[model samples]
Each structure stands twice: as C-alpha cells, then as structure tokens.
Target chain A: MTTYKRMVLASRPQGHVVPENFRLEEVPVPDLKDGELLVRNHYLSLDPYMRMRMEDVKSYAAPQAIGETMIGGTVGEVVASKNPKFAVGDKVQGMFGWSEMGVSDGSLLRRLDTTHIPLSAYLGSVGMPGMTAWYGLTQIIQPKEGETIVVSAASGAVGSVVGQLAKLRGCRAVGIAGGKEKCDYVVNELGFDACIDYKAGNLKEELAKATPNGIDGVFENVGGEIFDACLERMNPFGRIALCGMIAGYDGDPSPIRNARFFLTMRLSMRGFIVSEHMDLWPQGLKELGTLVATGKLKFRESVAQGLEAAPEAFIGMLKGRNFGKQLVKLI
Target chain B: MTTYKRMVLASRPQGHVVPENFRLEEVPVPDLKDGELLVRNHYLSLDPYMRMRMEDVKSYAAPQAIGETMIGGTVGEVVASKNPKFAVGDKVQGMFGWSEMGVSDGSLLRRLDTTHIPLSAYLGSVGMPGMTAWYGLTQIIQPKEGETIVVSAASGAVGSVVGQLAKLRGCRAVGIAGGKEKCDYVVNELGFDACIDYKAGNLKEELAKATPNGIDGVFENVGGEIFDACLERMNPFGRIALCGMIAGYDGDPSPIRNARFFLTMRLSMRGFIVSEHMDLWPQGLKELGTLVATGKLKFRESVAQGLEAAPEAFIGMLKGRNFGKQLVKLI
Candidate 1:
C-alpha cells in the first residue's frame, strides 16, 4: 500500500469559504478487493455547485459534512485492477473526491478509451458540465432560429458550451461575466455575438444594449442582480433554463425586483439537476466530441499545481478568478 | 337613423377612473351594411381590462381614445338584419362597447344559442371569462391530479371558474379573496377547499395552513403583496398562469419580492390575453358549458342597474367590492 494526501472539510463556511475550512491529512491507501480497483488521481475539477454542498441547507445534493473529504469529480489512471471492466493504465473519470489516490468499486466510474480523446477532456468538454449545457439548451430552452439568447457566467465550463451551441442553432448569443477579461474571452474565443460585464456599472442598460430585440432565452447560472436584470429584458414567450444560481450559493440572498414578471413577460423557467438527465450523457458526449474535433466548439482550462492548492483554487473560482474550467493537477 | 345614449371616454384618469373620465352622449345610431346586424344591448359585462384600455400605455389591447365609446362585451338582441342568416330577435354576444344600441358586421361576435343555458350565462359562464379560466388552467398551468392549487381574486369571474375546475380534477384548491363575504362565497358557492381573506391579518400563516404541501399551481389575477406571500409557499415544480395583475393595474408600481423564484422552485409563468387562444375557444366553451348545465359547475353575477353605472361597477370591481362577475344591466 502507498500513502496519499486528501483534503477534508474542517468547517462549514458562513459567507465565503477560506483555506482554513479545509484540512490536509495523510493516510495509507487501501488494497484493491475482489471487485475494486486502485487508482491514482490525475486531475480534480472544481465547480460552483461544490459551494452549495458546503452549507448545511436542503439542496438537490447532500451537504458535505465536516470531517468528510470534499466531494468532486476526478480523472485518474488505474494502477491496479481487480475488476474485469478496467485494466492497468486505463484512464478513467469518476467521483473520486479530493484525494491523490483512492480505491473504487467501478460503481461511479467510467473507463475512458485513449483512442477517443485526451483523458483530461473527460473532466471537461465531454463531462457532466458540458452535458448540462447541451441538454439544457437543446431540450429545455429549445431555442429556435433568429432568437436571441443570454447566458450568465459565460466564460465558465457550462456557459462556454451553451454560447457555442446557441451560435450553432443560428441564434444570436450574448454572454454576461464578471470582468472584462472573461467577457473578451467569451466573445473572441467562444464565438458569442456579444458579452456584458456585470461588474461594470448599470446592468440593466448594458443588458438592454446587448439584447435589443429582448431576450428569447436565458441560460441562468449566476443569480442576483443579474438574474433580475435579465428577467426585465425577457420577451413575451421567453424560456429560461435554471442551471445554477452561483451568486446565491454563499447564502447572502440578493433581492429580486421584477414585479412585472407576472404580466409583461411570459417565461418558462425550469431548475435542472444534471443527474436527472444522465441517461442522455453518452449521446451528448458523442455530439459534443464531434463539435470539438471539427473546431466548431472550443474549451480552456486553468490548472492549479497540487492537492494543497485545491481550497484556494475553489475560493478563487468563486470570486471569478479562474479563466475557464478550474482544475487541480494531482500528480 | 335613431339616436342612442352611449358612454364615451371624456378624459383619462391620473389614478382611478371617476364619473368625469366618462361622459354620457346621444349619438346617431349606426346603420347596418352588408352582412350587418343591428343589436340592442341587454347586458354589458364590465371587466378589469377596461382600466388598462383607459391608459395611453402600450398593452395587449389598444387604449380607449378620448371621445370614443368605451369597449366591452355585451349580450344583445338582433333588432334588424341586412342578411338572411339572422332573424330580428336572435340573442348574440359581441364586442359592442358601452352603448344601448350598435351595429355589427358579423365580425368579433358570436351568436349565443340560449337553448342549453340562460342568456346571461353567455356573458358570465360560457363566454370570454369562462374561456379565460379554461385555457389558463388547461393549456397554461396544466395542473395534474394530487397537486395543491391556489387562485387569487377567488370570488371573481375568472378565478371562481379556475378554482372549480381544479376541484373537478381531484386537486386541492385554495382561494384568496378580499373580505369575509367573498371568502364565504368562494368556499361555499364555488366549492374551493379553503379560502384566505387578504384583508385579514397573518396572511402568511393562513396561507401555510391552507397549503400544507405547498402550492403546485397558482392562477394569479391579483398581484401585489399577496403575490409576495404566495411566492414563499411555492413547491419545487410550481406553475403560475399570469392572467391579470389587478392589484398593480391602477399604475401603482410597487416592488414585488421574488427571491424564491430561481433557486429551489421551477416556475413556468406565462401571461396571456384570452383572444390569443381564440382558435380553441369553441372546445373550451363547449366543455365548460357542459359542466355548468350538468350541475358540475356554478357561477354568480353581481348586476348593477343602468348604463350610467358602468364606471362605478368597474371601480367597485377593481376594489374587490363585487361578490362575483360584475355586470351592468342595460335593458
């Protein structure tokens, strides 16, 4: 057996998570059983929904208790295999948590074939976040031709895919992000028609200019003042896919001021958990993979150095610090 | 041609419509042309949409012009006909406006065959208001069985029908009205499971008691602070049909609190004008009329005497003073 470092939740956060909320512990790795396989973590993905799980509130996902390892998705390589489905040196993606090495029973894991794409892409462009954007835009919102779509957190994992998909459907895609840098990245790299900086002054005016014909669809990720501003700009038959309200995950609830929601705008807003649409993942990945291979879709990643930097990376990502998919390199 | 007394818009009110906003004038009776019928108004249905038409702001319908007669739905008798399709005594319902007599070209009118129901029933139970409830419940909200539904302005024309239809579908129906009298009318006459009076204290507590499993469907007619209270008790997958915001119709733009709209609840809220669903009106009216004739549904009308009392009836209906469908008796 070998020893590996794992970060556990030390305390629950009140407003924003700090480095002190996580504790690094050294533990000996377990031996693989009859049905289990031993794996070494290669890349760990940090997402916004993790912040929601940190709080002790009723949510779609279970809350991460103190003294438990922080839950996340990880791309890893099998070091030893006892299961027939996986072999040694097989790259896999699973819910391996925040650890350098772990043993899995192949229950929540998928072995990736290297002939398809890079193993790291399994934690990104063809991953859960990517499928979320695909199913939400294609099935839920179902944007028609000549419609205008607005997406929040447009430079992140899910939002980037949503913008590209909107553009592919012959609709004008507008992105809203925090800083000018991410806004530029969304417009220049992701092929979004326009981008708005929510950190700048006058969100309503900016949204009015970005969506002159009024918003036909909104891919809502960040909820707060931005959500309210988008609500005001929705047309008569607008559709909204409620992906994530990251701005309210930290618990300081922002006031919503759209009184005319019951009259002026006709909206169909639906909150979606990715697990409910898991059955379509294989098909979604295949289509998204084709888009990526043909240069129709693009993705970027901001990698943190080691497991020790996971806490800071998560905090920075929440504060709009990362440029793309925030990941921690565990090798 | 003979002359008739008609009510015309003299001036637009700054806040609420009064006697001065309307003027009684004697005008030359309209002459019937080809495919035309001369109708003598027997009953005029005063509605809340007239308040919206009085303002110069853009809405679903055009604003009532100064010196032009106020537009409304009326059940009238065909006094003369230019074509052979109709006799002199045929009862019909049309967009005849606030007048004792008018000419119709068979456009925007429906002949009311009163063999199955009363003539006044066309103005109340099986006409525009009835169709509004049917389409709002069936097409817009689409409430399923075993769901808790709530309706505001519960004793009014549209809401009473909505509550009864909900009950017929095996769903628990709760209502919000103005006073104890209307609350009694909503519960006893309309067969709503429970009723809450907005004038009563502790609206939130009363709502919690009325909707123990949370509100799955909300048919909103009155919007204001009452809308805020209902937002708190909405379930995960709630549907709200924005029929009318009577509480905000007087141009009192107050901030509505809607913080719970995005995070946990999935709401499909859509505003609709009844005319938008005209293609399906025959099916809806047939179904609703069958329900009423077979004793499965019940309705009540609060009739005020004379054409000059239309403004007072409208103002009273806006303040929740009427018991049921507010109508003006012209004959």
Candidate 2:
C-alpha cells in the first residue's frame, strides 16, 4: 500500500480522555532502508498503561508526544524485508503502535509461530499482557498452595491470566470486576473461585463473602474502594502486587482509606511495571505460550473494527466499559 | 518493698487517651518462687504502639485487657532472685509495665551492662525502640550508600535511632517531626541531613526542599499527610518501612492520598512490628548497644516523674508533646 491511516496523540487530556485527544490522519507508508522490514499491522493492543503515557507525567515511560503515533503493542505479518533476520509473510510482534503499517529494523521485532497460536493471541494471552500477569503473580504475589488471592479487573487481559495461573498453583482465586457479566465470565469461564461485581454497590459485603478466609495476596489493577476493601481484608503478612491503578488514571484521586491496615496486618505491598523486568519475560512467555497452546488458559478480546475506533475503545476501556482485553483490528 | 505502686488499664479511650483510662493502685509484691526474680523498676517506657494496644482491634498483638496492668517496657534492678540466671543489683530489661516492681521468671528478662550505657538507655536507644529502628532500616529499607531516607517522628524513640543509623550507613537522612525544636534536634543533634516541621503548615514545600533527590527509603512512623508527602516524593523502586501510624492510632482515619504513586514509582512498603522478628533482635541489639556505649548514638528523654505520671505522659506522647523518648521515672 502506498498510503495508510494512523492515529496520533493530538493533545493531552485535562482529566478524562475524550475523542479530541487523538487525531486520525492518512499518511504515506515509509520507504524501507537497508536492514529494515515493512509489516502490515493486523492488530493493535489498547491497554490501561497507554492512558498513563498520554499524560505529561514522570512515569516509567515518556509521555506520548503530540502529533506522533500513539504508542501501542501490535502483531502483524511482514510484507517486505531488506533485513536478513525477517522474511516476507513472517508473523511478528513488536511495539508497532496505532498504525496500519510499520517499518522496523528487526531489532524491535520478534518473529512468532502462528501455527499453534493465532496472530491475535500474540497481542493478548501470549504477549505483554500475559507476561505482565506471569511476572506479577509468580514473582511478586507468589501465592502458596491453598492460599487465597484476589485480582481486580478480573475479566481483562492481565487479570484473567493472573487468576488462571493462581488456580494452577492451587490457590483460591477470587476476582473483582466491574459488572455482573464480567464477574460471571471470571468465575464460570476463567475458573476463578468467586467473583464480586464491584458496580453492585455492595462491594464490601460481596468481597467479605467471597473471601471468608481473608485475602492472602492481591493482584491490584483497579485501585480505589476495591483496593481499600482488599487492604481491609488482607491477612497478616499479605502480599499485594500493585500492577495498575486505572481507577485513578484520569486525574481523580483514589486514596487508600485503610492505610492503618498496612501496619495492623504487617502487609507487604510492591508496585511493579512488567516491562522493567524484561529478564523474566522469556520464562514467563514460555509458560504462557505453552498454556495457550495446550488450551489450559482462556482469554477473550473486545476488538474495535478499525484504526479510527482505537481512541473510543481505549477511552471506554479506561471507564471499564469494555468487557475483556480491548484491542483494535488494523486489518 | 512489700507494697508497690502500679498502674492498670481502667478503660478504653473513646477518641484520645485520658488520665481516667488508667488507675494507679498499691499492691503487694508477689513472693519470688524458684526460677523467679523480683525487679525494682527504675523507668517505664511509653511508646506509640501502646495507643493501638489500648483499642480492642485485630492488630499485630492482642489488645491490652482492661483492668489489667498496662503494657510497657521497663528497665530495672534485680533486687530479689531465686533464679540461677539472676542476681540482686543486676541491671535488666523486661516488659514490667507501669509498676514500681515486677516479678519475672527470668526467661523474659535480659541482663544489661550499664558500665558505659545508662540503665535508662535500655528503655530508649539500646532497647525495643532502637531494635525497631534497626530491623526496619537494615532489613526492609536496605538503603544503598548515599541514598536518601526519610524518617517520620524523627526526634521520637524509634525514629531518632533510624535517622542516626541511616546516617551511619552513608545515607542522606531527612527527618519529619512536629516543631522547630524537634526538627533542630534531628538535624543538629541526631545529624539528619535536613528536617521538615509538619507543624509549620508547609509540609509539602519543606519536604520538597529537604529532599531535592527523591526519597529512596522511608521509615514511616507517623502516617497521614506526612506519609502522603513522602510517598509523592518517592523515587522509583523506593522502599518504605511502615513502623507506626501514631497519628491515626486514636481511632482516626489516616488515608494515603498518594496511593497512585505506589504503581508509578514501583515502591515497596512493608509494615512490621519488632517483637514479631525475634530472630533479628540479637544482631540488632548488639549494633544498638555498641553504638550507645561508644557514644556514636545520642538519645534524649522526656521524663515524667513517678508512676502516677504514665497515663498523662502516654497521652501527651501520642499527641507529639513529648520531646524525645517519653519515659516515666518509677524508682
């Protein structure tokens, strides 16, 4: 293709993200130089961390620059290559972002085996999200057999894998999700022991009921009252893998009211970004890939049809409107 | 002495502690049996954890039972002994509570050498408070040389030792305390790099000024806005040793408003009670004892004369009224 469509960050969001924060434009596909490959992007992974990068803040990553391609994870098939490492029609995964086509030097691209796993699964269950779950659950939370673990955003890409992995480790995996539909999927489909519908306005009661023995470990994604409830019920020396705080990502403050519980329970909480722990990704991906290939791990995606739908899908995902791992179909 | 004065918990505090919560009574000293020693109490240590124990809450320890002798650490002289391990006139430390005399089985008591260290120093610097500081700093925070560490309640018993020890380990020790006097003592006397007076109503600005380089380690004693301010200034992968939340001890809520920082900064926070980590006490106490004995560690005291003064002194100490280690002279 001589030209393609892409979205760029137009402006930084003041508080809540709106459509105006992004700009969709038609641009010429870049000419490939030596040691470069051109990939036709198939899918773009829209995640919570993108919302954080949209703001001008000191975080693990630099802010997504205005008038630049909005940063994201992508799985695509190489269409053309001048690089010896990558070949035409090779299924690959890289941070190709919100574009229909991308040019890369192969350094950032990883050739994938699409025979057992679908190309789309590389953007969800067997990709960064899966590795994130693996690193946080296995390394940080480290729940022992028969221990109880609570995961927030339970039906999403990361939380789903976390709960499933905990179950495999013989843990009582409890989940807290936004709605009844998501909660049902988390318990029935994803194999979580119990799932609490946080929007039911009875989170405290439901959470207490779900976790009678109290929370031994927490994979915290949505940090607010949900996180506070988990903190209140944390067992002595409980571990919290603070992976994300999507509830407060839009400039709203979500204060932890049970700060005293940290002392009273002698809890240990560690916040982490999985990308910084790249050393474990190979081991994590190997486990995740095997689980997905063996059909032991299940994941669902809420795919927006085109590149233009990326912004709205992301905004909806941030508000917990999307049911599962939100993605954009580029082709 | 056949009869001795002792204080007992008469009731639980409604909000803040009052003198009415304690009852001073004259009781006959129990006769020492085999393997027992009678201690003539010299000083009673008043600390923040006592405030939490006053409430019937599920905490690190069981609530101090009402109408029982109040729980406290005591340094005393062994005046009568039927145990082979004890001798009359030996300086010792034990949990003898708010009393003029105590009967111990010698198993709970530790003999002290007061040749260079004062007998009362065992209650403040080289005792539980000092060991608490050592465990939190060395074990949890684990600061690398030249990294900055912030200690709240910096002039108080545990906090003072933390700052001094952090400095000894080649750390930039910043302190947070109540007033100018305590702040000055922290910086000048205890050798903290800088001190922020929370009472100045410019905690944010003062903390920002004091810690130009973001805090790498935190010994959090007084949780509330002070802890929040520190959280906001935490560097990536910062470690927080949550030792106490005295500000919220009197049935008040001390919410952490900067909870988002836990994820953004990838911080690690651990709440600990020194008594629970008996394995570390020997090493911790050895370092503490040698520091005080060699004059490398300096500690001040806010002495409340006589056993009758304990309740008021404890109440005052909880309110940050005591200058340093709040102690009641019982001899």
Candidate 3:
C-alpha cells in the first residue's frame, strides 16, 4: 500500500498564522474507484488568499474549516486511473490542497499540456494569477494608449503580469514593488515605464514624479496606505480594479484616507475575485496562455521544496519576502 | 438700466459658512448684448456642491473666486431678449448665481414651461437632484426586480426620488434618514419597504434587521459612519452608487471603518457627477419628468425667502436642518 503526507488545519488563525495552526498527518493512498483517478501532486500553489481562508469570517470564498485539508490549487500527474478521460501519467490541475496525492473523479481535473511552458507555470502565469491580471485589466481598468497605469505589488505574480500587460497595450506602466532589487527587476526585465520602491518611504513623491500626467487606471493588489497614495495621484475619471487587500488580510487595516477623492475625481472602483467571473475565463486564458507559451509574457517564481514548506511560503508572501510568485514544489 | 442685489464671496469659509464670508452688494445690471437675454431672478437653487466650489482646493469645477458672483443655478423670467431663442415673459433656467438679475448669452439658458409640473419642481425633482437620482440608480446600481436597495437621505430630493423610482421598478426600497419624521415620510409617504433612523445609533443592528436578504444596491448620499455601517451590511456582489458624501463636505468625516468589506464582498462602487453623463440626461429626464407630472414621483423643498436668507439657509442645509432640497426665493 502506498502512503503520503498531508497538512490539515488544526485550528483557525486568530491574529497571525503560525505553522502549529496546521497539523501534518500521514495517511495511506486510497484505491481508485471506477471513473476515479489518483493524482500525485508535484506542485502546490501558495497565495496570500490562503490567509483569508484561515479565518472563520465571511469572504469571497468559504472559510477553511478546522480539521479539514487546507484548500489550495495544485498541479500533478495522474499516477493511476480507472477513467477514460484521465489516463495514468497525464498532467492535470485541480484543487488538490496541501497533499502529496489526491483522488479525483475527473470532474474537477483539467488536463494540461506542458509542451510550450513549464509545468509550474500552469499554477503561476498561465493559471489563476495570469487570468486575474488579464480580466482586471481588460474589463475594469481598460487603460488607453498614452494613458498611465499604476500597479501595486509590482514584483509579485499578478501585479508583474498586470504592469507588463499594461505596457503591451501601449500605455505607460508604473509599478510599486517592496524592495530596490525587485523594483529594478520590474523596470529592467518587465519593461515597465517606471518602478517605485514602496519601502523607500517616499511613495507619494515617487509616484507623483513617475506619473506626471496623473494615473488614469490602477490595478490595485496591495491595499492599505499604498492604495491610499495611489488614490491621491489619480486623474479625473480614473478606474481602480481592486483585486486583493493583502495588507488587511491579517488584521483591520487603517481607513483609506483618500477615498473622498472617489467623488471629486469621478472614480470607479470594483473589487473582484477571478473565480466568480467564470464567463471571462476562457477568453482570458486563451490570451494569457499564448503570451506565456510564446515567451512574450514573462514571470518569475520563488519555489519552496515540499508541501511542508507551504505554510512558511504563504506567510512569507504576505510579508513581501517572496520576490515573485511563491509556490511549493513537491517532487 | 436696472439695479440688482448680489452676494459676492468676501472671504473663504473657515469652518462654517457665515454671512460675513458673503458681502451683500447692489450693482447696476449691464445691458443685454447680441445673443444675450436679461433674466429677472425668480428662484435661486442652493446645493451642497456650491460649498465645494467656494473652497480654493481643486474640485470637479473651478472654485468660486473671491469678489466674483457665487455660482449657482437659478430659475427666472426673461425680462428682455436680443436672442430669438428667448422672449420677454418666458420662464428660463441657467447658472445665474445669487443675483436679482442676470444677463445670459443664451447658450446656457433652457426655456421652461410649468403647465404640467410646478416651476420649482424643475429645479428639485426634474432638475439636478432628480437627474442625479435617476442616473445613479439606473446606470450604476441597476437593482434587479426583487433585489433590495438602500438609499441614504431618503426624505431629501435625490433620495426621495431614488426610493420611489426603485419601487416603481419592482425592487424593495429601504431608506436611512435623520429623524423619526423623515423616516416615517420615507416609509409611509414614499412607499419604501422600510426606513431606519440613523440618529437612533443602532445602524448596524437596524440595517441588518431592515435588509433581511442583504443589501444588493445602495444610493449613497451620506458618507462617513453611515456609509461604513451600510458597507458592513452589504451582500456579496453588491453595488454602491456613491452620489454624495455630505458628511465630508465641511471637514474630515470619520474614515470608512469597513472598506475591507469591498474585497470580501466583491462590491462595485462608482462616484459620478450627473453633468458628466449628458448622454443619459435625455432618457433620465424623460422618465423623471413624466413621473413628477403624473404625481407618481413626490418631492419636497424648503424655500428660504429672499436672497438675504441664502447664507443661513445654506448653513442650515449642511446641518440637515432643512427637510428636503433647500432653495432661495429671490423675486
């Protein structure tokens, strides 16, 4: 009998999430029933959204219950199958959680081809994060050519793609990343018009100098003071696509000081979850997949080894310790 | 030649708009030029937006410069006309300000007929406030047939029309007003499903009980604490049409304590000035005008008799002293 290790929620997070809040358990792999396939997870997606799931509060998605497997997205190979759709060794992606193996009935599993891109890219650039950038930009911000767009968390998975996509659409892209190194990479490698180091304690002045014409569109990922600063620099009739508030997931963040600008500036802001907008996924994926496959779109990942590193990796991402898309690589 | 009473901004308001900040002066009205019409002011419209114009700060419109006429909308009778578009004894509306006589170039003047509706109704329900309600409700909120909608300042010009229109569209209308009397008017007279008195100090609990299905759409006029309260009670995928933030006009209102709810609820909020949406005015005004003429839509206005009462009336209106759309009779 084959066996593997998995992590489950031991208790709901109170303030900050710690490793002990998660319980690592070992269990034997279950036998595949008819139409069921067994997936040995090779890569697990660790995101800031997981911190929100740890709380027993209302959110876009249901909270992760105690004693239940930690909810996440994963890419793996079908090691055994009794299904006609998913044969053994077929690459697949699903909500496989923080487990080494998962049994699926092919309903939730989507077959993947890694011929053009790497397997891990399925969880980062061409997957949920990539699709998020695509949908928020096209549907919400809709940056026009020669107009300026500001993106927060500019070195991270979603923001990196957002800024690059803004550039490709013939707009001036300004990025706000945590460190000097990341900001440099965002400017040099990502081809953003300008990258501001948010940690430099001069966001307002730096952003103003970078976007002299005032920002017409903003793809906001990191909310809090960073968002407030961006709000101050927005031009008339600006649009803000609020994808995440990673700063407020752990605790109650300070009020946005410049929200009053929404009125005077005739601004429109919408907070969206990519999963809720399933209608746009097909079209978004087609564009995002082609960009990633052809290497026209670029992305970077900070991968941690083994499923056990998920908790640490996730926490690090929230603190901006991860330089890019944080993921856990399970061999 | 004719002489007229006028109020010019003497000094910018410090905290509250006092009479001294406005200097009452008499000036000889200039002769009408070609393509110009002389209007003897009948009624002057005072609104919160005027206060924004008085400040030196940048706003959607230029600030009311010191020693210049305080800009405002007015309804008057054409006393003389050099333009074929207007003739003597014709009723007209334009931005004539706090003056007894105005010389318009005819470009900004719109001829009015009060045969179907009251002359003042054109300024309140069928004019700016009414159009504001229509655009915000239909374009931004877009409540479904059975969805619940909440409107703030529910007994006032904009809110009264917002709730009634919502009801006409087959949606449940809930209102938040200042006092028991206004709340009663909103529910009993306006046919709203429920009205919550915000002064009662149980907004969170009261709003919860009022909107059992949760709030799907909101016509937000009051901001600060009330907005935060309403935000906390919003359902997932809710939309807020932020029409006004009257609470923040004078000074710093309390910050929205629950803005994080935007992310958790997947909400959309847009702040707009109805003047910017001229494309929809024709359609919106047609609907609003028809409703008022048929007695299906109701509105109330507090008229401060003569131009001298304007400053005090404006100050009173800001404090919620006036029950509805406050106006000044200047004839």
True contacts kept of each: 0.48, 0.90, 0.71
Most DockQ-accurate candidate: 2
lDDT of 1 by residue, A143-169 (tens): 999999999999999999999999999
* Candidate 3 ranges beyond 4 A from true positions: none
How accurately is candidate 1 docked according to DockQ? 0.42
- DockQ for all candidate structures vs. native: 0.42, 0.89, 0.71
For candidate 3, lDDT tens digit of each residue in B56-157? 876788899999889888898999999988899999988889888899889888888888988788788999999999999999999899999999999898
Worst 10 residues of 1 chain B by lDDT: B254-263
Q: In order, what are the TM-scores of chain A for the candidates?
A: 0.97, 0.99, 0.98
| Best-matching candidate per lDDT | 2
Task: Give candidates' CA RMSD values in order.
Answer: 3.0, 1.3, 1.6
Which one wins by lDDT: 1 or 2?
2
Minimum summed lDDT over a 10-residue window in model 3 chain A is located at A250-259
Per-model lDDT: 0.85, 0.92, 0.89
What number of clashing residue pairs does each candidate have, in the order they appear? 0, 0, 0
